[model samples]
Target: MQVSVKHSLPGRLRLLYDKNEYTSKQALLAQTLITVQEGILDTNCNTNIGSFLIYYDTHIVKENDVLNLFHALTGKYLEDPELLKNVDQIPETESIESVLIETLAIHYLKKWFLPLPVRTLLLWKSLLERCFHVLSKFAESKRLFSTELLDATAITVATLTGNKNTASQINLLLNIGEEIEEITKRNSYGNLAQSLLSADEPVQVVEGMDEKTVPASALKKDDVVVIRQSGLIPADGQILDGEGMVNQSSITGESIPIAKKAGDSVFAGTVLEEGEIYIKVVQTGKETKVQKIIDMIDNSQSLKAAAQQRSELIAEKVVPFNFLVTAATWFFTRNIVKTMATLMVDYSCAMKLSAPIAVLSAMKESATKGITVKGGKYLEEAALSKIVVLDKTGTLTYANPVLEKIYAMEGFTEDEVLTIAACLEEHYPHPLGRAVVRAASEKNLVHPENHTKVEYIVAHGIASTLNGKKVRIGSAHFIFEDEKIPCPESLAEIKKQSSLEGYSLLYLSHDGILVGVIAIGDPARPGTSEVIRELKNLGLEECIMITGDTEGAASKIAAECGIKKWISQALPEDKVKFIEDEKAKGHKVIMMGDGINDAPALSAATVGVAVEGCCSIAGETADIQLQKSGLDNLVTVRRLGMGLLEKINENNLTIVGVNSALMLLGIFGVISPQMAAILHNGTTVAISIRSMQPILK
Candidate 1:
């Protein structure tokens, strides 16, 4: 791909490339990759003019960096040809103006150019298609009620009155309205699909005994990719070797960093918080699983909100009344023109269309802000839930934990215990692990990995052989009760002091003998206290904390966040039971957490919100997935969901108020049937376009 610099500024650059050669999908893929890079503030790739524009911070990025990046991308794409498999997710949609003009022009051109009989047959053929929907629906219920049946009645009345011209105009307007609605909806989905675009980059792969760097897209099934600290895991794969603490907040919605090791599965979009691991690729691009889920959500009617479902039911119920109005006009006045006027106003049409239109528009607006709502149903739940349950670890505190103190047993110096602990913890880069490793590094302690074949039992301690002696390190339960290692008498004093100080403990035992203890302290994340206040201001009735941590530690974090209710030392089952109990009491509970343990509770909550750094299980189980970090977006989502419901209500009121006036004017001889048809369809089209407009900034 040959390129030339079109222009350049201190912090901006534009390059010209051949659109005819690269294709729009390739250009978009290139843009997605560039946008995610640090220091590149913005990117605008206008495929129309083949110009790629980039804005950056002059201090952070250089002009040569931009050019070199693109040069490297060219070879990377060649290595993995299917990198663009999900790039073309959004289909091109025609503007409403184009659809309306084309529909009207096509409808009239046939009437003018074709012979009388031919035009008549074509018009009836089009009208019959509308009649077919009505007949098909009526077949199921054995009744003449539906929005489609009402549409057919208007066309039939126009023809019976010997007004073929009115009939043709009516059909043409319906066709135009339908086309505009279809285009509007497709545009909504297109906007959302843009948010799911793949941001590909190069990654390190292990071959033989050495590691090689390759494009993320170049990875194939069974490829062993080495992910280091702060590197994004680029594919869904199982860890083949090594261990690390993974922060999945950006992808799986985990609240804190999770420990990953050999045999553990890793997902793409999760950051390697600490350590390094070799992963065997299971899937790439996240399109096979995610794209299909999005498809299922789009087509599944069961996922629609209750209000949307009610609007459909209301639309169908009113169709029968539309028939009654036409019948009364004919029976009392014996006026064919008045009957036709009532026929022109199909009251149910606008009601049904506007509801889903509002939902889709709100959903599209949310995607821009990095909120992935699975369905409209959850949005509604966000508004109604008052009792909010928050997970402590990653939600209230940062993943970065600090090693405040180390209490070595008698005869062992603090330095000796720290060195030994860091050696074992270096493999797992989770919050606590990262803290231990960092502490050792800051002290210039040289700790080498001399242990052989360490085993990590999840939710327990790690066991391995060190210098021909068995060693274990983890929670007190893992070291004492689980391993049956007796604790030293002095350790009881340390435990009492640590618990009162609200510090989490890590116990280390060497060769069945208790050796030392380490204390880890956590600070509240910036603005967490304020976010809790904001949630309360937004009508959250009560906020509570549930955790597996000791009561003292959980209480300290909960107090920092102003949470008064809590249940500590709870297992995964306990969290679920808490949510179910709240729901049973008729309280709408919103649960937020990010961990494997949180998955069941998330499922049992009235609305499950998976915060940043979540595991795959929690992300998949939660009702909503926050793509970005922090609780600010949780506030944004709650507002957005509430806004959607309000918009739908306002739209319903407008549809009813405006169309009812049009119907009255038509029946009372104030407007002709044709004029009523024009106004009625115009109102429907207006509301639909309004619904597609932004609900949030």
Candidate 2:
């Protein structure tokens, strides 16, 4: 139980334990370390090195405290002689090969040791039970000759005619198919769920003005918590105090970090990229927004597209016709082989299996491309999307705006103007504000905290008091019209030049007079125009740009991106209305946006595409999420959708053509019932495999 300090930092410490002492109780020691009352943020055990890494909040707990706790826990473990024995009793995960071997051994023992009569009875009982189950399903659903019914009929005929081998073969193939389907589904759901799970590290919660570290699961609604820079928010909550930039990209599909101050809400699973804040928990556990998203993703298969639903319905309806075909064959040919052949060559098998396989395969492909398509229905919608609505900022344009120029009025020097602007702008997390602060940093300009607490006016500017003088920085509309600040006529030429050059303007004023004008430029993303052209080539009828920027700025960006139509000074509602109008006109809309303001429009579109790193709300509302912040993958998704449809059609045609040929061969006595069943089922399995193949290439 003895330990020594391996590494120590301000809020982190690592200790190495003796491998001979705690050889198998690393997990037990890890559990004990986390239970320490001192604010230990996280504990990680490495049995190989016989060490533990501890991260704690320096504000609440010190390095000495952690060392003392580790010593105490080790002493407790040494005092309890039975602890190691108890730890050894915990089960380890079984290997897949081991599980498979065990299953095969059990099966072999039952099959080889049993008496012939008993084996026959056991096999017949299993076959009859399966047959009756299928029959019961058919009776309840009123669908005849489905895959289940076809399977049951084939096995029942084999058993009745004393062809036990044929019955056994049919049952084995059915079980294999079911296993493949179940594994495929489990893998798909697991990938998505794992992607959305919150971090496993402990979070620091505020208890009566003092910080305490606890596991995220221990958090409850109304509890206050602290989120530091680069830490994941453990639960959905509202900010109580302080300010920070939160990256809700995992939830929102937008890559931009949003500025959150007091009274603003933040969700679990999102990371705090900069600054820190105290949050009052609003939701926790399964009730969190991320959990709701996971639940939606889990149930996404239920929201099937019209085509998928129709395919299923047609598969079911074709069941009765399959029975009729078998009956007709038996009556005319007077051949039991032909009747069984017709039953084996069921249309429902390929019809039901291939569609889902194709969809799931496409989903897997999309995931590899960093895109997550919620359901097959959204892919279908994307395939037919004609009108593409794009949000300007953080969508087509780069989220990181660069400071191009600054025009200072007569009384203020450029450095003085920039320093003051940076001082106020540093308080918020807006992209433009961050640009100004970044520009100041690059120039090695030092801007002390010279202003009072800044008040951010959403969609406007920031207001504060600097040296007892009124200071304001925001849009031209906010300064010139709302604040009644008069811009000097001498600066008109600078403003005009900036607008002509496609630069976004930010006006800075002090004491009711315009002091400076800052020009910010956000370049179009790399290959943006080429991607737009490619989208057009791929049958996108229209690509429009919508933004809250001025007409001149919007026009310049639209021209650069090869988009002919654009709407300037658009609000959240305007984007929503544009999508709604397109839908009303019978256009399947693909709305791509990356902001909290873009959520409503995303929801209204036929398929909402959220870019990588977008806000959490946008991700939840978006039908498709692009893990990479680019338009190239959008093209990939479109092609994938078309390929899925083509694959489904090809599978249908092959199933029909091959089965008909097999049925005719059976009728002429060229093929036996066993051969016909093998061919029919083999073709179904082959087509299912083909459907799962990559669609891109």
Candidate 3:
């Protein structure tokens, strides 16, 4: 238990243990050390060198406290073997393979070396236990031909007939198959969980203006951390000083790199794709937004699709019929052997196992391609979606909009209009707001807090007061129609000029009079038309674009994107109503958007997809989050879902056809009970493996 401190800091420590002393006990010691207090954030153990590192909150517990606890625990463990009882064994997941190998070898040896009476007794005992286990499941819910029932029945019949060898063989095969199934399921789920919880490499933290490398767990709120190009942001915080193009696909599922400068907010798990930034941490640990989203996804099983639930119910319901058929075979044929064979080939094994395997595998495959589908049900909806409703600004086009021009009315200078507009818009994160703020920054225009707190009206505009004068900025519909603001006849020509440019216009007003018009140019994303065509070819019957932009701008973008149906100046409620109307007409709706205004429609659709670089709210509201920036990945999701359905259907056919053939052969005396047991179990295992294969390939 001798240890030496390899490194030490205020909130962190790394220790190297005497390799010869600890040997295989490094993991046990590491686990025991963390239980010393709740201040320990994380611990890592390298058993090979008998070294461990601990990260803790110095504000809650000091370094001496942890070191003292570790020493005391080491002393106690060395003095008493009783204290090490529970920690002596390796974890089950770490040793399952070895355990299976050893068990198989021992079973083989006993089968050959043991006497017939002893073997028969052992086999009978195991068979009885298995049958009891199956019967116990009735307390929960009855499933007549469950794999447990099939296995128990097969082994019981063989043991009663004094065919001890056949009974042992059946039990061994079933046990091995079950182990393999458990391992496969765990591996698939583990792959995804690991991906989400994967730790980043040590990050550089600026402590009192001195930079040093430390584990991400060492980060605390308000700590200034320096992130370089391609470095993952260690925690959620605001940019204090520096600029970068941040790729937040990991957190928000957006693939486009956002231009982040001083005063802008960033999230943990996002990467600085280019440049560097020093962020003042606002939230760390499990309090970060990404962690919360991951927690939600982890617990989203309740959202399972109707089809998956039906498949499970059907699997269970067919079990009773399997038992009935076996009884009929025994009654009519008057052969115990045939009855045993019939029991061996029930549909429940493949039916129950293959469907979930196909679904989980498809989910894993989608994750690899940068799409996160919360559950299998959403995949079902994605495959069946007929009508796709798209939001124009961030979903169909890039969110990075440029301020093209600004026209000021009489009594207001262009700079004055932009300064006030920027001050108001900076409080919101919409594309238009960002465009105005960026323009002001580029022009070196400083707009201080010359206004009261801004009020954001979703799908409308920003309302605030500047120098006791009411000011508003938003779409033409919001300012002129909703707010009842009047556009002066003198500015008619200016409005006409802005409209002809095919750019989106935001109206700015002062005291109920339109004083300025800001033109924002956000071009349709490249390949939009091609993606729309591909979606149609893939069976999307209707494609529509809904936007709050002017009719001219919406029409121009829709035409460019090959969309024939376009709704202009539509409010958030209008988009929701559109989806509801489509659903009422028997069409399954898929909504794709990346803005706060799109949240309602996204939640109302059959399948909601949030594109990469979307706002946090949009990403959270959507069912499927696409990590890629473009629409190309949308097709991948559609195909993946369809592929899963196809694979499940194929597996069903295979299970039914193979089991039916085996039953016929057994009843006709063409195959023995032993052969039936082997073939049926082997087929189930093979199909289960096939179900886990990549759907796209």
Assess every candidate by TM-score: 0.81, 0.70, 0.67
Those runs of model 2 whose alpha carbons end farther than 4 Å from true positions after fitting are 1-124, 162-220, 227-236, 243-276, 284-294, 324-338, 408-487, 492-516, 668-671
Native-to-model Cα distance after best TM-score fit, residue 666 in candidate 3, in Å:
1.4
lDDT of each: 0.78, 0.75, 0.76
The lowest-lDDT stretch of 10 consecutive residues in candidate 2 is: 85-94
Alpha-carbon RMSD, each predicted model: 6.2, 8.7, 11.6
TM-score of 1: 0.81
Residue-level lDDT tens digits of model 3 in 257-350: 5678999999865667556799999987633534554454455456665655666777777777777878898889988888887877777777
Candidate with top TM-score is: 1
Record all residue pairs in model 1 with backbone atoms less than 3 Å apart, i.e. clashing. 248-613, 249-612, 249-613, 253-614, 254-613, 254-614, 255-594
How should the candidates be ordered by lDDT, best one leading? Answer: 1, 3, 2
**What's the distance in Å from true for residue 662, model 1?**
0.8
- RMSD in Å for candidate 3, one decimal? 11.6
Model 2 Cα shift for residue 121 (angstroms) = 4.1
